[model samples]
Target chain A: MVKALVFDAYGTLFDVHSVREKCNEWFPEQGEAISQTWREKQLNYFFLRQLMERYEPFDQVTREALRYACKANDVTLRDEAEEELMEAYLNLDLFEEVEEVLSQLNDKKLVVFSNGSPVMIDPLIDRSDISGYIDDVLSADGVKQYKPVPAAYYYAQQELGIEKEDILFMSSNPWDISGAASFGFRTAWINRNGLPKEELDIQPEVEYENLKGLLEWRD
Target chain B: MVKALVFDAYGTLFDVHSVREKCNEWFPEQGEAISQTWREKQLNYFFLRQLMERYEPFDQVTREALRYACKANDVTLRDEAEEELMEAYLNLDLFEEVEEVLSQLNDKKLVVFSNGSPVMIDPLIDRSDISGYIDDVLSADGVKQYKPVPAAYYYAQQELGIEKEDILFMSSNPWDISGAASFGFRTAWINRNGLPKEELDIQPEVEYENLKGLLEWRD
Candidate 1:
């Protein structure tokens, strides 16, 4: 019996890529390049920081990665437009299935396990106002290390007060799914982009292209 | 006070991107996509594996990353051709200025600290015939973790019997530079592509566009 659903917030619960629209609105053709590279660099920086023991908040990582992304793509951040994009990022729209599936599964505890800082995550939840469904927000700063580090998962487990097997852990990142699975959670990989499994030899218990797959299964 | 000049093997001394020529040769007009994606996936796998603690040999990582890159880029890896590429990989030619600079800096104890497996690193050194300059080979398998991990650098420091700052660490990767610098080694980033520094806030002591810059520095 799954007692609760633990979600990886950035890509699994909220669509990190949804910033592409605001990006495109601001910069004509460079939005996709900026958005894609920014997201990739953001995660890459997370791993680098964790390994190097130079921990920074996720919001700072986001801005710094964006700076690198724009520079790498030969785009300029002018007139404080980058700030606009960052602000818009905080209100990132939920994935099409997020609200519905989350509501339908209200009987189970809904928890967010995020790398986002409280300042960054709390507003997004407030703006989206689906905050009611969530029982807890476990941001990585709680442990001073990001996810995939065993310490981060252990912290989440202690807070959730549920046995690892009794929780359904969900993430859209293959690496996160692998990490969570390796940590003994029943993992769901929300592979929204239809990417291949990470070649880490560990496999998630199930995968969905979107969040609704979880709802459909639970229904 | 720099007693040894430690190098990163894959991209700093060897031309990893040279695989693009063979990739283009094997699959008509698909070389750049295959090579770039292959290299990116290779490093991505390193971080993922290290974090997941499901470490594999670097050679195995090269093969697996290539498999993913080929699939991601819609290119098929023919059986004999992948074998052919792996064989070619073993004999990757030195970067244009690698041998010349190593010869110029022969007074220093030149060393290689790589993520390559011995099977991969030893043969590459032998085939390239630059074994005379390198006094030591420290592969990551010694600790079963990839670079930017403190343990990997720690092993190298112990093996060299030299203090961290006394080792002039060199790599073409910004993350490696950042990691080494954080580990208290003076670092030289071979920024061959003139790429921006990683957002980690740890800048290298010096940077070069290629290996020749190191020689030019000592001169």
Candidate 2:
């Protein structure tokens, strides 16, 4: 039952919401609104780009969404603010328990399958001091699709030389978990929002409250 | 050339978020969060279903997402609460100016192209007192595609029996406006959020703060 535990980067193993903290420091007037808009727009861009069939780097897409949201919310962040936001992205905080949970899963193959570029993810993983425990880092750029794309899961499987069934895909986004399930991979949806998955035709094989639950989960 | 004016139903013509007012009476503890999560998951379901080549009535999708979000936020509602929410959806408040603006364009073929089901939308139009001004109500259920899907525009055009070039698609969602534009229809994006459209290599021919701008728009 032990195979690869493929962890999704944003909102799964990492404290993606902490990106808000960094924004608050820069644009105090409308920081919270700008940050919320940025997150919403970033996800919107992901799906929009997928539908449009035009792939762009996650960093570029994230930056574009942040810039527009700042403007819309009447938060004027100069070029330096933009750079600071991008730096925040590269330096995203790891969830408080991510390192310990990941270490427990280290006995099995541990891989990072993310929509982010290697450049963006590498620094975070390195900063977490858990890079040594990771077996591989797979980027969506190679597959030309973001999470919730079947190809994204397939890319990680193909790159790791494992069957879909051998990879236990994990993500906080229900759609990403749905995609993995559809692709015939066993999945543990990290429902950190404490929500149920949207009623899709396929359901996840396992649902965990967070990585801690997932750490104790054995198939 | 006055040919046709199309409007997005949610947030543009109808005040969909006004439903939040009733949330306090039902799930007072997490009313605001419940409402926000419902809207977010509703869009998530639409995009995921469209990407997966599956379709469901927006009401079913809406109810499912609502239930998920409510549970996630620890808000428990009685069955009557569901009925109340559904009723709220059908009884949306139109902006003070929406009726007057639609009246101006009524002489020139006004239509509603919505992401709602006919069941969900038709009732709203009937209750909102603006049904008399609309010539047609087109829903994604007709095409098995949601807004931002290229097929939504094509299906609307075919249903309207109008050439793509002659139809003006209007929406507050940039993704939808961009999709309609890519589908070869002219679009006027209602930038109600004051945000620029992300760089998707697609652009709306017109941009406006509200539908009133469209009444005076001459092209």
Clash pairs detected, candidate 1: none
- DockQ for model 1 equals 0.63
User: List-wise, what DockQ does each model earn?
Assistant: 0.63, 0.40
* Candidate 2, B1-219: lDDT as tens digits: 537888889878877678888887787656678888888888888788766556788998898888877777877767999989978989889977888888777668989989899889999998787899988888878977787767677788889888889988888877788888888888889888787555566799989998888877887
Candidate 1 per-residue lDDT, tens place, A99-185, comes to: 888998898899989889888888888788579899888888889888898778888998888899988999998778888998888
Query: Docking category for candidate 2?
Result: acceptable
Q: What is the per-residue lDDT of model 1 for residues B161-182, given as tens digits with 9 covering 90 to 100? A: 9998788899998888888999
Could you tell me how far off, in angstroms, the CA of residue A46 lies in candidate 2 after the best superposition?
Answer: 0.9
lDDT of 2 by residue, A111-217 (tens): 88888887788787877767889888889888788877677777888898887887888888877888888888898898988765566678998888888988568
Candidate 2 chain A: 10-residue stretch with minimal lDDT: A192-201
**How well does candidate 2 match the true structure in TM-score terms?**
0.88
Please tell me which predicted candidate would have the highest TM-score against the true structure: 1
